[model samples]
Target: MFANIIILILVLLALIFSISKWRIHPFIALILSAIVLGTTLGLGGESTISVVLQGFSETLKWIAVIIILGAFIGEVLRETGGAFRISNRIVKWVGEKKLPWAMGFTGYIVSIPVFVDVAYILLQPVVESLSFKSKRPVLYLGLSLAAGLTVAHTLIPPTPGPLAVASLLGVEMGRMLIINLIVATFAMIGGILWVIFFLKNSWIDYDKKLQDIYKEEQTTTHNELPKGNWLLDIMPIIVPIVLISTGSFVTDNLSGWVGDALGFMSIPLIAVYIGAFIAVFQIAKKDKKNKVNRLVEQAITKSALVIMITGAGGALGFVIKASGIQNEIVQIFSDFPFLGAMLPFVVAAILTTATGSITVSLVGTASMLGPIIDNFPMSPEIVAAIIGCGAFCVFHVNSSFFWLLNRLHEVPPKVLYKTFTAQSLIMGLSGLIGVLILVLFGV
Candidate 1:
């Protein structure tokens, strides 16, 4: 027992160090960690290989489909000028004085169906336009948008990270979604206030380097398609959420009807795919030339990469669970009187900080804590919220989201480390406090 505990701790530390300090890819690092964990725990070479392969296979089943469909939907939206139409309509409705708030709202809504990085990329031109017109630092508008999107992407369900955690822990999606929306809203407000407070008066002189990049981005125009109605543009994004939420409610409350007519009608994952199909047809039919083939090809290509990455993270989590290391760790943590309640959050934060992959953190933490929750008198909803909160605590060089911000907004490495990193830390800690309070109240 003692030996296994030591090995587990060592494996975790090594995984973190390799990714954070040595700059190793998380996919490589996770596989290596699985091998070391299996070997140290007395799983033979063949067994370890089998375990890893099985893990990968199991994760790819559902994750790959969801990610691919989600990505395809996002790509179609971007190419069809759906995102631009939505942003422009939003800005016009809210007016320039309230554009920051509008951008924040847009980020929160759009990011539900789109990946964080892709959503940011889609809205970059809009933000740039606002900055140019306002003659203010682009970082202010960019960060506001980023905060909204990141909070929802990290904390909300139906997105891969939070959904993975909730699924592993057997938490109901409806409950998780309720908690996620509440916490995410608070986190977004905190982030927006932080950005506005700091960047409101700060003058960022437009450097020649940035100007050149901006000019280049402006010139790279694709085919000009007709501007779709704002309602049509926004529906593709909202349909998935409505479907998933409805499905979750029915499945949880009306289990007898799950596969029955009403229950079959409510399956969220199915809703997402159906929504994707609708989005493709709607966007493609509007185009005059080779619409069907072009839309299908674009959707397939765009979704493939994200789906692979998500599946890889899932496979890594499965290996960890199958190794028995997570079970042992849970037992050890559960024995502690005070630490047991806090174990999920702490483990999640540590894993997230180390792997720089929220998906990995969710899988690792949820896998380890699953048994603990079953044995203890705690709400799985609280456990899910804690894990979600911990996943955003630290954003550093290892995190791709950090780099996305730096590259997209032309933020210097130093500024990113100072400002964006600080904002994440604050958001994370505040979330932790919220979780801790819930735990304290035995909620």
Candidate 2:
């Protein structure tokens, strides 16, 4: 048992070193780690290969379509200017005095489907405009908006990080969404309050390069496409979640034709398909042949690598479970009860902080810990949320998002450390607090 545990740890270390230091592709690293783990465990070659194949296929079958559909919806939302319109409208509705809160909510909604970086780029112009109009600090709005987007991007399903984590840990998507949303709200508030209290007086003076880019973006006119209806534009992302949740809740509680239909609608795959259909419908007849088709193709192409990495992680997890090391690891964790619950979160934070990629952090940590995941006292849903929360904490120089914040907002490194990093820390700790509360309440 000790030998198996040591072998597993070595394999995980190799995986991390390959991805973080050697710059090897994660898919390759994960595959190699699984192979090494199997060899060390004395699994026969045929069994090892079979387990890898089965795990990869199973995970891809369950998650690939959902990921591609999410990417497709995000592509449509980006191209339609719907995301921009939503943020802009929100800012106006809330008025400038509450700009940080409004931007935070805007990011929260926009990030439901879109990648956080892409969402930031799409909404940057509007946020800049608001900053200029209101005479508020750019850092204030930027930090708040980023906090909201970062939480949802990391916590919510179909955004990749949380989706992959939930899938790896065997957490149901409906439950993950419900619980993560609730916990993430608390984290988001922590970040917002940090911005409000600590960064209330902060501002960033635009540099020449940023000024020129801003001017260019402001001058460019968008092409004449169908103007997107705000609700219609957002429906593809929101409706599916509603349907899936309803299906999850209603299926067992109610019986009859109504129950059957709702239950069927709630299946995540079907629900996402319905959402994708709505999103696809948004492309106008004039643009469908040329633009919409291309966008869908692009989305699929883009999602391929993410799908591969997730599938590979699943393979590694299968090997771990098949090796019978899970029970040994679980028993070891049982010796420390609090550490058992917090282990996933700590692992996720360290990986994210080290690699600067939340997706990588989630896949790596979840795969490494997945075999013993059931041993955690907390429900799988809450455990998944803890992982998501940890993945978002400790945003710093190694992270691409940190560089994006630094470059776009032109905040100095020192200021970013004080503000952005500080806020992420607050949000992360607050998420942990929420999870602890739930644990105590026996939820």
What are the TM-scores, per candidate, against the unseen true structure? 0.86, 0.93
The list of candidate 1 runs beyond 4 A from truth reads 207-226, 250-259, 286-306, 335-338, 367-377, 433-443
Summarize candidate 2's per-residue lDDT along 321-402 as a digit string, tens digits.
8998889888887989888888988988888776778888888788777878778878888889889888876888877888
lDDT of each: 0.70, 0.81
Error of 2 at 128 (Å): 1.1
**Best candidate according to TM-score:** 2
Write one digit per residue (lDDT tens) for candidate 1, span 1-443: 77887877788788778877888766777678877777778888888878777766765666556666766677777777887777777777887787677888888877876788889988887777676666557777887888888877887755777766765677776667777777777777777788878877544544333455455335322113355776887776777776666665665566454446545544556767776767765565455356656655775676665445445555555556666665666666666756766677788889877777776777767755664466544688877887777877677877888898777765777887767777777777677666666666756
What TM-score does candidate 2 get on C-alpha atoms? 0.93
RMSD of each: 4.0, 2.8
Q: In model 2, what are the clashing residue pairs, if there are any?
A: none
- Judge candidate 1 at residue 221 and give its lDDT: 22
